[model samples]
Target: MMISLEYIYRYPIKGFPGERLEDARLNLAEGIVGDRKIGVGSGAMAVNQSGEWTPCQAFQRMTIRPDLTTFQVDRHDHILTLTAPSGRSETIDADTKQVEAGNPTVGDQLPVYRANGNKGYWDHPDAALSIINLSTVDAISQVIGQTIDPLRFRANIYIRAKPWSEFQWLGSQLSLGEAELDVIRPIDRCKTTSVNVKTGVADLNMPALLVRHFGHLYCGVYASVKKSGTIVPGASVKITGKSEDRIIEAAANAITAPALPDWPRPMRVSRTVEEATDIRSIWLEDPLAKTGSLSNFKAGQYIRIHNLAQTHTWRSYTVSAVDGSRLRITVKRDAGVGSQAMHSFNVGDNLTVSGPFGEATLSGKSKAHHFLTAGIGITPTVAKLRYLYAQGFVGKVRVTHVARTASELALWDDVVDAAKRLSGSSLELHLTKNVGDTVGAKLGRPDPSKLAEYAKSDKADVHICGPTTFVNSVMAALGSIDFDEEKIFLDTFSSPSVETEMRPIPASEPIRVTLQKSDITENWTPADGTLLDFAEARGVVISSNCRAGLCKSCSCKILSGSATRLVGEEGNDRRQTLVCSSIPSESIILEV
Candidate 1:
């Protein structure tokens, strides 16, 4: 069969593994018909002060039986129950709304959680349901030159169809009953995808596959449920290839054969680290490493790391260049099943390794000084720093690192040596026990402004890697200081802050405006403020996805106004942005 349906599963919990399914009906604005409809309050996830969204990490220790798939927790009335796969149901009652919602409680208060071991956390609240296409998984493997399991690209439903053999045709269309969905865009891969859910090691194969092959390893497509109904596992899937069928085939063929450097591949490891805390740098030992040209890799870019124990839980972690022929990867232990299984690994254990994904690369072309910032985020920057230094880059170079303590520095000595090797280079260290008085720490997070301070001399080219929020703050702070956004390079986490800026013209001050593609022109004022508020008034229905700037669903470009992007990118300051949540800081021309 060209496209064959084999497995259907429902993960009642978000990140935790799930029970396979024979079928599940997609329902209106919800998933699996009645799935997650009635989860117990488990205690509310309280954020600073007046309850914000719950933090998923707060409930990490809650357990669920691997065999059970259905459960419920009622907080206000204090009720909980479980439906075992055996069909045996158990129930309990307790009035714990206060506890589930994280309200003030006396003594050892814990989150009231639901069973089934699934996390309900989503990047945003409206991620009601998700689906995956097996073809994409197959395609990613071809590009990165590695075999990736379908489950690594997790989704509630896995479709089998014509495009299953094709790499990216899922963006075209598929008929499931009578439903039609516009493939909004790719579901971008994340760092979470790289963490071996089972082992917590920085595994690096799947990501290498995507970054090397497809330009980006993102394979799955996100869809708005066009038609809702039950989806059974064995049910038939029909793919109507793209009308430009040859283009479809071309794209499909490309996923497996994307161009990249031939690696003196990293050697594979033969032993596993049994301890949970050990850094499992699984290598693909090439016999020539002792005397042969070693496989060279860049920093910040990651590789897919497989669980020698469970292939399904494979992940990616940034590659750190400890030497030319060999690579290093670090792991923070996971408390879940995936990490628990990785606990069986002992050093020298082997897991498949693919890539040398080039998420971070050298653009020595810029005549600007190289400002390398390192910390937890320096994995990629370290590679870049070493790459530049080894290439005899003599231009002005400086290294700035922020660490909690001197001893916590991972590879600090190596970086110091590298900085010394460069002619006229400078290395400045920023260590903080607290953000207390450090020019950096007090801000409470990383911001581009703080980074600019490290620039010290000229506004040199910048590259940053860190937590998404830290990166976001850096990007935002950098924008405020007028740093050339484009000059800044990144291998970053996508934070939903990339948005446009709009402003109101007082009713007495009429502003001339034009909508580029729509070819609409009008004089607008504060009376017709809010770009969305103004557009809808003018019958310019700016198509929007989430309207909250988080989804990047309504990204458009600015033709005129000096847009201060909500989510700042280094080189993209001159580009347009998300209009859904933008406020006009000035008169601007926009392209939708």
Candidate 2:
């Protein structure tokens, strides 16, 4: 269904009150002009008025004093006026260093201090703007048996769309008037939404309501303005293709045929070392290393490797180590064809590898870094530790590596040696099957209590890389101990299975599939298999890699019609659908 922007609101002073706007200019770097340029701090909330940014909890919020929501705020250029429910009004210049209020005491005798900054004050560094769907709010109101006001969400933009449809826009670009916004991530609801805007009462429990109905505490979406322009109420909002589709299209148009430096580089395996019984490490060197043509990669990134001689086989492997002009990737023998081929690789073998992608690297700002890994997931951690050692990191660093057995601990010696070279760094090895208490070794998996002990400090960031089950379990354990999920980072080698079993499509009812861009039509039943399989069978070439859905190479825009994604998966959005695991629920039209 088509949706349009219905309302716009901007908060000049965070947690104070919002000002409605007929039209607002969005800036690429600063977001909505004059939006949250100042924040209010109180005695109970400590904030460094002269220093860098801090968390929103360190500032006065509506959750603590819902009375703030009862105040009406209006902004005109540099002048801001706040009118309380008692008809008492106060005017202050927004450019002034301090703002005075009619009632000095807001609630419970809390004195407010104005904290200003050049950049907008936001709950998240990247969340400069927020959008909430009116339909989602209505749906929640129905579930809660009350009329929910959109103002309670405190979003910058409110739009009328299908319930929960805003989530489909994630990783997509939205065009509102002349502005373009890149919807980054879902915004998790907090206690602030519980405050009633008109009555100034902590009435609705939005976070609890969301968690009870949606399995998560997310309500709205966070977006960054990509193009600067004016967005007004009643503007038509249009979403473009999914972000992955645009990325793939750009790469295809920029790079040509046989070989491109950034697309894939030809390399030769210079050395091979057996890390464990089923694990092996291969060192790759650029054939043109002398010319400085080899691409440099980050420490915690991975590369997709393809056998040069066997063009049909390729797989993604985490970079285990880096030296001079050589890159090393550790591989565990698996039943997969790519792993089998990698296991049979010999020195001097030629291979084509691409990318140093992934963002789970060590943050320079983090004083305490925790690395948790299981099985061959330790590969990336090895590169990270090596990088820390080279940088002479003095932070409190803890590494917990788990394996089925001690022999399966790939790169054990390298990790231990790196830990020894870095101050305040320690390595603990765990064997899931064995109960032997070796030095610096544990008998079982990671203990939540021990993890908490290591992470019990400020400025700590947790990096977790492992299989899906292992990572999920560790995340749950951390959550149980009240660890902030935001501080935890994850990189899983496998995507969650879309569905345990594919439902049989009835042959009696064939579904029509139309490639709107290509002007091609095909009929397919459940027996015909997935949309990707049917398209390939018809010689319709669609770029795809990692058919397991971890890589979004096969994502395409669903121009019209509906389709059913694999159970438990979120790819059912009409805007974007992954053809690999999607089945036509009706006559479907696709942009690909």
Candidate 3:
């Protein structure tokens, strides 16, 4: 199979129409020439002030303002003409230093800036070229029952290849024409890809559809130029080298682990640091840096420590961060048996552990995101915030952390630093006793009215993590404002009331379940919350990382009767169910 480039494109101005080229010149250390050299920003968004690379939120983009796609731009010599869908037109002299443009929906007369660097205003900081396979676009079109235009992807180069073939090129060196390039990673699909370039309407949910049809939310690959050369549309693309672990390289962009089995292994504490007064951070890794190092968990997930010497019981703790192959868990010492055991562990101590469980995570969608936390609850949110910042998230973000005093604030530096990295992002630290930082600090508890005012108007997605009292109060506040209930995600660290589970429901009957591979059969009752729980009680191990059903690790095919999934479950096809969040409705046979 011969892979050839099908098209070449450049977006001279960000959030504007793309300019097709007959040929393009690729340079070493830089991507396509004259691509994304300028960007337009509205009054609500700030233009890059540092004369350097800034995140995409600083400029107008289709993710936020889809109406910008209604315009078609053509530059002839020194004259640039922009024509709207309604036959309205505007012209700008390229010689002029100041460029002004107006949109009917967003506002009028937005400012355009010409960035002064080779990096331009590209979303990724690496100044790389984005490539998409036309076959993958065709597959998405077939699934959605619409002919998708390849331009909707906004890639620098379009190629003719097999569907999903680009994913194999991760970490591989590719040869295109006379240029050599290194494929960085897979590009995660977002709301921008759902917009129709011609109609300016987001009629399709690209992220959800991709995750449903394919296992992951990815369609394209980003490559950094290595060797300089001129390339035409029909140039051949060849894979020059392979990646060590393509799965890990490809999944680095999304919150997913590799397709591997789960086991209890001993992880050694490589290092420990005092994060705050009573808070300590420990980095865990494989003792020999061998097989277990590949367990790349996601942010907001927790690891289960098993068989502690003192407690002799299994416990779950939030994995605060992931540094390469190491897992960092921040612990605040308390009177709990697990906390005391963990706090006593020193460097070189071994602990048996499994997991990276939980469903509460950051959804890679286009919307304002608010993280409301209290005291040590900030652990998971801070981890999520750091991951978002690294992925070049370009959306409105607000983080509110409440603590007794500044000395007790955990991961304060990480939160402040991530806020600075993300444009249009704000951090609000509330201290009941002392106000160490006056810049963004407030005294007293978080007021529900203020929380509503910040999140209600934008309909932002809110993540609340704290004690039972704090979580309930925040839930009530959002409910009082009539916020969308479905948009709120809660940390599932606490158990629900026993009375509620005991209440009778329509399909609360016992059902027979057969696990084919495990060769186990059991009768499940309402007491078993989910199929995963029932299987665990029966001594069956199903490969799982995030037990929240968001990560499709526990997805199994049904061979017989029907199964019902929970209301908010996200993954699985017609024949499959994520056992973590699904239950048997009647007698069922599972492939397992």
User: Which one wins on lDDT?
Assistant: 3
For model 1, what is the error of residue 238's alpha carbon versus the real structure, in angstroms, after optimal superposition? 36
Give the alpha carbon lDDT tens digit for every residue of 1-592 in model 2: 8889999988887887787889998888456876777665545344565534545655566745578887877877788777768777766677876534423434344333444454566776566789999988887787668998888889999999977667556557899998988876566565578788888886755654553433234677877777899999888999875454443233223321111223444467899999898999999985434333334456777776643222234466788877877888898998877788888878987665555555555766678789888988887777787777777778888888888877787888888887887788878888888745556677878775567556756457888888878887777777777897778877643211222233444454988999876677978887666787677555455665433343455688888887777633544557778786678878889997
Mark the regions of model 3 whose C-alpha exceeds 4 Å error after superposition.
93-106, 242-592
lDDT to native, each model = 0.47, 0.69, 0.71
**lDDT (10s digit) by residue, model 1, range 1-592:** 5554467655443343455666666654344532332233322233222222333333321221111112222222334343433445444333222325321221134334432212234332334445566755665556446665666555666775433222233335555544433332335453335444344342553433343333333445544344566665565656653333332233223322222221212244543322122333333343233332234455566655432232334445666664545666644345654445545555554443434554444666655454445455655655667778777776777666566654445655666676777785776666655544433233222345656765535557777665566567767767777777777877653211222222323334666667777676777665553455455444454544333343343567788874333323322234666664454556678885
**Per-residue lDDT tens digits of candidate 3, residues 219-320?**
788787778888889999999974345433333432232332133345778999998898999999743123333355566888767544422344667888
Model 1 residue 298 distance off true place after TM-score fit, in angstroms: 4.0
What's the candidate order when arranged by decreasing lDDT? 3, 2, 1
Clashing pairs in 2: none
Question: Which RMSD does model 2 reach against the true structure?
Answer: 22.7
When 2 and 3 are scored with lDDT, the better candidate is 3
**Pairs with backbone N, CA or C atoms under 3 Å apart (clashes), candidate 3:** none
Clashes in each model (backbone N, CA, C under 3 Å)?
Answer: 71, 0, 0
Give TM-scores for every candidate, taking all chains together and pairing residue i with residue i.
0.38, 0.42, 0.46
